[model samples]
Each structure stands twice: as structure tokens, then as C-alpha cells.
Target: MLVKDMMHPAVCVTPRDTLATAVRKLAHEHIGCLPVCDGMRPVGMLTDRDIAIRATAQGRDSNEVTVREVMSVGALCCSTTDPVEKAAQLMHLSHLRRLIVLDRRAHVIGVISASDINGFLSEPRPFEVVFYKEVLDHLGHTHRSQLMRISMAHGTREEAVRAAILEFEETRRVNHWNALADGYDVVSVRSNS
Candidate 1:
């Protein structure tokens, strides 16, 4: 099956769009990601996690943060004519569930998710099932590992909990988004593995 045969019409965001607006759209749509578009072409991706990790965690005012500031740029895309399996392979490699589908003009026509692929099937193939599982597993592991470790000083017990949460947010920003990695505040920690 071709990507165009299964992809959903994309709901995209502009680079000038604010994080606050993006969050509202995400919640209202019950969707995980938004394509950051320049006109009809996708330029980046803003996942729900990106708002939490890259915006909320950064101590930046959500109203002031634009999608371009934290979006995962240079999104993976596929021609509308490409086979669905090819899109799945790209998703597996990128740990993504959705892919932007583009036309000959490099304009986004739609997006295809693993769910869309599944809907295309009455009985999914073994590899398709496995690929879907692997994508979920990878995403799960990534989120769990965020804010894994951080230290912050606090006076009261409640304050300590809040501080720790903020510290985790800061850590996730530095480690995942590299927001402040160049600053002197960064301290590298060795991984146990």
C-alpha cells in the first residue's frame, strides 16, 4: 500500500506558533505531535514531550516560546507514492510512529502513523507487529529515562520535591535538548552502563 493510501491529512503548526497554543491544540486534538510547517512544507516536528521537556522544563515562558525554538527540525518524510513498508522502516529507525507524506513539490500532503498502517490491515504481518512494538518500546524507554537524575537544594520536604522536579526538568533540557549544555552550569555524569 502507498503512503497516500493511508496517511491522514496533517494538522501542522507554524514556526511563529507559541508553545501555549501548541499545547492547547495537542490536548484538544488528542494527538502526540504537530508538524512544524513553512507554508505547505514541513520544517520540523513538535511532539507533546517537546513542550514538556523543551519548553516547560526550560523555565521559559510558554507564551514566548515559539515552535521553531524547540522543534525537532528536518523531519523524516516520504513521497506519497512510496510503499507503506518503507515509511515503517523509516519510523523504526527514527523511533517515530508518524511520517510526513510529501508530494512532488515537497509540500506536505499528509502524515501516516503506525495506527494508520494498522488500520490498513485486517491481520497485520509479523514484522509489522514487531516493528510497531519496537517503536513503542523505544519511545517508552526514552520518556522513562528523562529526568532520571538530578539534585537541587531545598528547605522543606515539599520544597525539596518541587525542587527535584524542577531539577529534573533542567537536566532533561540539557541532556535531551542540549539547551544549556554549553553553559558552565553543565556537569557531565557518567552513565552506569
Candidate 2:
């Protein structure tokens, strides 16, 4: 499936928004990330990690900060049509857990993460079952190892694997596969040609 298929629409933040407000929204909504937009165009992304690392780490009060202050600029993104595997690979390479989905003109359309993929895996579908092997194979060694580490650290193999996979998807490196399958046929052909 493509990012557009699963990404959350109605993405909720802009650069000028205050960190305090963002935090409140996040807490209220129980979400961990936000796409920072300039009007309708996405300019960056803000996450719980950015606030903890950039603001709290510096001893700054979140209440006084702007989303721009702690937001990651030039945020990794994916096109709506990009393959799910490609998104996963990007996440792994960048060590990121969320990615903003964009449209043909580079406008923010939605966001996708490992969580979405996990949800897809849990749902019953014939196509999903068939593609499962392809999905696993696309998640390369580094990605797999990262997932294992997360699993070990977090105490749940399933959750860890999902987190790792989603993290990579969010970073824009969606080309991962299970070791057994070689790689996605389309991706391999594009890389070679």
C-alpha cells in the first residue's frame, strides 16, 4: 500500500504555533508528532522528541517556545504513491519514526508511520497476506537489526518490530525487504536501470 492509503489526514500544526499549545494538543489528542506547515504547505515537523531534546534539554520552558524553535527543518517526506517498503527503508536509514506524506506538488497530504503498517498487518486481507513476505524482505538487515534491538529494549518483540519499521517509513527510506525475498521487483529494477 502507498502512504496515501494509510496516512492520517487533517495533519495538525504550523510553524508559528507555540510549543506550549502543541504540547497541549498532543496530550489531548494522544499523538506524538505534528507536521509544521506554512499556511497549507508543510515546512517542517515537530515531535515529542524535538521538544524533549531541543527545548527541555536546553532548560527552556515549552510554554515560551515556538514549534519552529524545536521543529526539524527539511523534514523527511514521502509521496502519496511511494511504496510502503520504500517508506520503511527511509525511516530505518534516518532513524526517524514519523514521516509527512506529500502530494505531487510537495504539499502535505498526510503522515504515515510504523503504527499504520502494524495496523495493516493485523487486519485480515488476502492481498496483505500475500504481500507479507515482500514487506518483510524489503526491510533490510540494518532495519531488521534495529527492530530486534527495539524489541529487546521495549520487552515486546511485536511492538519493537513495528516501531522499527514505522520509524524507517517516517524517514523516507521505504525500500526494505525480508532477507529471504531479495528485494521489491520494482525497486530493484529502478536501482539497476
Candidate 3:
């Protein structure tokens, strides 16, 4: 699918807008982010988290701080005609929950996030579904989270460790395992529908 096929037009703010304005939009829209734009062109992004960390935690006056002061600069954007896979890749690489979509004229058109991809995840094959879902989990959602842990009382040898790993993977798909160390080598097994 193309970005134009799935993206929704964004709610936005301007650089000159106060942080108070952005916070109000976030609450009113019940959304996490807003594209900071100048006319039709996007310049930065403001998120709910930014307000919490930059203004609230720092004890700054929201009405005095502009979006330009806390908004993240240089958003990642994909063309309207670009494939959905391209958007997924960019979001994954950038650790972003959503990406801005732009037209050929570099005008902000819409937004694409993992939630939008959920509707189009109608792949016929099981593996294809799993593939997209795994990417989406890293991109935004966390429907299933898998973790693995291994503990040894004796010597740590290569062949034995490999066998132990393989055994643990096949049987312990969710939640229980004796771990080697505290919070060491955790793995998120891909979820299936």
C-alpha cells in the first residue's frame, strides 16, 4: 500500500505557539503528537512527552515557552506515493511512532503510524502477518512482549549453552525462565496472531 492510501491529515501547531497551546491540543485531541508547521510546510514536532519533560519537569512556564523551544527539529518524512514499507522502515530506524507524509512540493500532507498499518495488515500468509506485526511492535504497539532468561549453576561452555538456548526458545514462549544474570540478554520473541 502507498502512504497516500493510509495516512490521515495531521493536526498541527506553529513554532510561535506557546507550549500551553500544544498541551491543550494534545489533551483535546487525545493524541500524543502535533506537527509543528509554518503554513503547509513542517518544521518540527511537539509531543506530549516533550511537554512533560521539557516544561513540567523543568518547572518552566508553559505560556512563556514557545513550541520552537521544546519541539524536536527535522522530522522524517515520506512521499505520498512512497510504499508503506518505506514508511515502516523509516519509523523503525528513527525510533519514531509516526512519520510525516509530504507531497512533491514538500508540503505536509498527512501522518502515518503503526495504528494506520493495523487495518491494512491483511496479508494472506501467516509469516507475512508476523513480519509486519513484529515491525509494528518495535514501531509503536506492544501486543505481545516475549522475554528469555537462562541460568547455569556450573561451567559455561559453548555447545551446552547453544543447546540450552535452543531448548529454552522452543518451550518457554512466555514469561518463565531461570536467568543467568539480572536483566541480561533479554529477547522479544515475535508474536503471532
Candidate 4:
């Protein structure tokens, strides 16, 4: 699969946007990060951790700081058409869980992360099984059932399922592995949708 197949549609912030604004956006949108953009061009990425480390930890008022102050400038990104494995490798090497997916003109297109890879790996049939059983065994029945219902209702299987897992992780749904496991329940139901 390629980055385009896995990344989400562009969701970005502006350089002038305050760290406080970015935090609000992240919380309101239920996202962990956002690409800093200037007229469709991605210049950087601001993550929750960035705010925590650079602003909160230092006792700096987020409202007084701009995203440009704490954002990861010139973030490592990949093209939409790039192989998924390559993107995963880059993420691993860069110690970044998320990667900004770019378009032909280098505009932000989507974002991919380790969870996306795990979601892809969980698909039944032709793909290799990376963490399927482990996921199911951990999440159990109730939570898995809820995830399945959401996935089936939306008809989002691989990439979308991964995105959901990532969201669950941010919401502190037990653990990432448990979230991944619950994601399998959604994947199985989504296939029938």
C-alpha cells in the first residue's frame, strides 16, 4: 500500500496560530497532532508532546506562544505514492510515530503512523498477521463490540480502523495494544459493510 492509501485528508494549522489554539483544536478535533501550513504548504508539525515539553513543562503560557515556536520544523514527510513500508521505516528511524503524507506539489495530504501499519497488518486473508490475536485477546468483548459497530457503520476497514485505534490511544483507552486489538473487531465487521 502507499501513503495515499493510508493517510488521512489534510488537517493542518497556521504558523500564527497560538499553541493554546492548537491545543484546543487538537482536543476539540480529538487529534494528537496537526501540520502547520501556509496556503496548503506544510512547514511543520505540532504535536501534543511538543506543547507539553516546550510550553507546559516550562510553565510558558500556551496562549502567548505561536505554533512556530514549538512545532517540529521541516518535519520528515513522505509522498502519497511512496510505499507504506518505506514510510514505516522512516517513522521508525526518525523516532516519529506519525509522518506527514504529502502530495505532488508537496502539500499536506494525510498523516500515517505505526498504528496504521498495525491496522493494515491486522486485516484477514492475504496480508501477514502482525498483531491480530494479541489485539483480540487483550481488548476482550465489550470494547471490541463497540469498535466493531463504529467501523461497520462507517465502512472504514484498514486505514480508517487504524485511525480509530490512534484516536482511542489518545483518549487513553487502556493501552495502544488493547486499542489495536479492539480495532480488529471493527475490521472484521467493516469487511461485511
Candidate 5:
């Protein structure tokens, strides 16, 4: 699979945007990070964790501080045509959840996350199933030691809970016509994943 095949459209913010504004965008979009751009050029990245550690923990006011004050100095990017495996490896090395996707001209186009890759690798399932799996993967990695200590006690219970949770997610998808309306486009499940 190619990067473009898995990347979702990028939602961006400006350097001058207040942390409050950026946080709102993050929450509204249901994304963990955003590319901070100066006009059409990508400059850096802002993540929820960045805000928490650099601003909130420091007691800086979100409404007063700008994204420029807290965003990572530079954005990591991958070409749209690059292989998905390459992107995944880069993310693993960098300990990042997502990377900015750029066109040949270096224009930011989209963002790709581990969730996207995991969804691509697995057989198609309800969105909620894939989402929960990704969440478990992230938690397991993030708290590897803690989980290992408790794994024996919770292993069977965890599996049962996961199965029950996934079973509750609606598996049926609504079908629609192949043709698009004049000004509308549909992102198929393959690409949406």
C-alpha cells in the first residue's frame, strides 16, 4: 500500500493560533495532532500531549499562548507515493502516532496514523472494531511494563471484554449508489481506513 492510499486529509492550524483555538480544533476533529503551517508551507506540529506538557503543566494560559510557543520545531513528512511500510517504520522510530503527507511540491496533503495502517492490514471490519484494536495496541505499547506485570491476571478477562465490546459495535454498513452527486464525493471504506 502507498502513503496516499492510507493518509487522511490534513487539517491544519497557523502558528499564531492560540492554544485554546488549537485544542478546540483537535477536539472537534477527533485528532491528536495538527500540522502548523505558515501560509501554504508546513512549519511544525502541535499535539495534545505537547500542549499538556509544555503549556498546561507549565501553567501557561492556553488562551494567551500561541501554537508557535509550544509546537515541535519541525514537521516530519513522507511523500504521497512512498510505501506504507516505510512510513510505518519511520513512525515507529520516531515514536510518533502520525506523519504529515506531502506532495512532490512539498505541499501538505494529509496525515497518516498507525490506526490507518492497522486498518489497512486487517480484514475489513466495523470502524469501531478497528478503533478499539488500535487503542489497545497503543495502550499496550505505552504501558508495556505495567501491562506485563498484570497480564497473567487479566489476560483472559481482557480478551473477554474486548470480544464483548466489539460484538456490540454495529457490523452492518449502509450501501449507497456508486455515482456521486455533482458537488459531492464519497470516500470508500478502503480509502477511509
Candidate 6:
């Protein structure tokens, strides 16, 4: 299947739109993201996660904050004619649940969400998770960086995400694993699907 075959009409928002307005559209559409467009071209993507982390968490007034303030810049896009496998790969690598589908003219034509990909993730796959950490040095004056990577095979993405955090905290002997509260990236180590 191709992206164009499965993509639905994109519901877009402008950069200057307020977060409150965007949230309304998202709720009304029952969608997690909206393509942020300038005219017909997609400039960015505003996701529910973005709103929660960038605005709500920061205690900013949603009515005063603009989409451009919290929206993720440089929205990943796939050509409408591209194969569904390509879309799946992009989403898997980027940790995005949807991607903007563009036409030949580089116009926002529609959106291809994970749900739109037929059986793309029906089978189980091993995912690699990397945790970046900052630890205090022996002097207690400097911060040192460390990282750990783990492989997990969970039935669902949500399960994989939670499991990764739990495993990291337990294995690393850390009290809290708050770094991934916003989100984290994972790569499919192997896929049998």
C-alpha cells in the first residue's frame, strides 16, 4: 500500500494560532497532532505531547502561548506516492505516530498515521532504548554524563516505553527516571513482521 492510498485529509493549524485553539481542534478531531502549515506548505507539527510538555508542564497560559512557541519544528514528511513500508520505517525511527504526507508540489496533502499502515506493526519486534543520564562527579562540583542502552520486546509501544524506564531505573540503581517523561526514541533492533 502507498501513503496516498491510506492517508486522510490533513487538519492543519497556523503557527500563530493559540494553543487553546489548537487543542480544541485536536479534541474535536480526536487526533493527537496537527500539521502546522504556512499557506499550503507544512512548516511544523503540533502534537498533544508538545502541548503537555512545553506549555502545561511549564505552567504557561495556553491562551497566550502560540503554536509556534511549542510546536515541534521541521515536521517529518513523506511523499504521497511513497510505499507504506517507508512510512512505517520513518515513524519507527522518529518515534512519531503520524507523518505529514506531501504532494509533488511539496504541499500538505494529508496525514498518514500509524493506524493507517496496514499490519505494519502487527508482529512483535525488538526495540533498542538508550537512556542518557547526568551524574555528579566525585568532586560534587561537576556533572558527568553516562548512557545505557537496553533491548526490549513488548507487545505494544506503550508497554515498551514503560518497561524501558523501569528496567533502566532498576538496573542503574536510580531513584527516578524522569528524563523520558516527555518522550524517548527507540530503534527497532529486529523485526519479524
Model 6: which residue pairs collide?
none
Clashes of 3: 1
Candidate 4 per-residue C-alpha lDDT over 1-193 given as tens digits, one digit per residue, 9 for 90 to 100:
6678878776789999998889988998888889999988889999889999988999998889999999989888889886565677678788899988888998787888788787764454322212333323454643223332222122335655565454445434456656444334432432433
RMSD of 4: 12.7
Across 1-193, the per-residue lDDT of candidate 5 in tens digits comes to 5799889999999999999999999999999999998876789999888999999999999999999999997878898986565677678889988899999989988999888897655554222212111123644553111100000112244453344232222121213211111111111233255
Q: Which stretches of candidate 5 lie over 4 Å from their true place?
A: 122-193
Query: How good is model 3 by TM-score?
Result: 0.61
What is the Cα-based TM-score of model 1?
0.60
Candidates in order, TM-scores: namely 0.60, 0.60, 0.61, 0.62, 0.61, 0.61
Q: Clashes in model 4: which pairs? A: 135-181
Q: What lDDT does the true structure give each of the candidates?
A: 0.67, 0.66, 0.69, 0.70, 0.68, 0.80
lDDT of 2 at 26: 82
Residues 1-193 of candidate 2 have per-residue lDDT tens digits of 5678778874578777888989988898778888898876888888889999999889998778889889999889888886565676678789888899888998887888877776654443221111123223554533221222111122244443454455434442456534333222111111122
Error of 6 at 98 (Å): 1.4
Q: What is the lDDT of candidate 3?
A: 0.69
Cα lDDT tens digits, model 1, 1-193, are: 5678888778889999998888888888888888899999889888888788988887999889999998998989888886565676568878988888899999987888888876554342222100001123644552121313332222444444444444433424444323422221222233344
Which is superior by lDDT, 1 or 5? 5
Measured by lDDT, the strongest candidate is 6
- For candidate 6, report its TM-score: 0.61
lDDT of 3 by residue, 85-159 (tens): 557656877898888889999998888887787555533221211111112455676453234333222233443
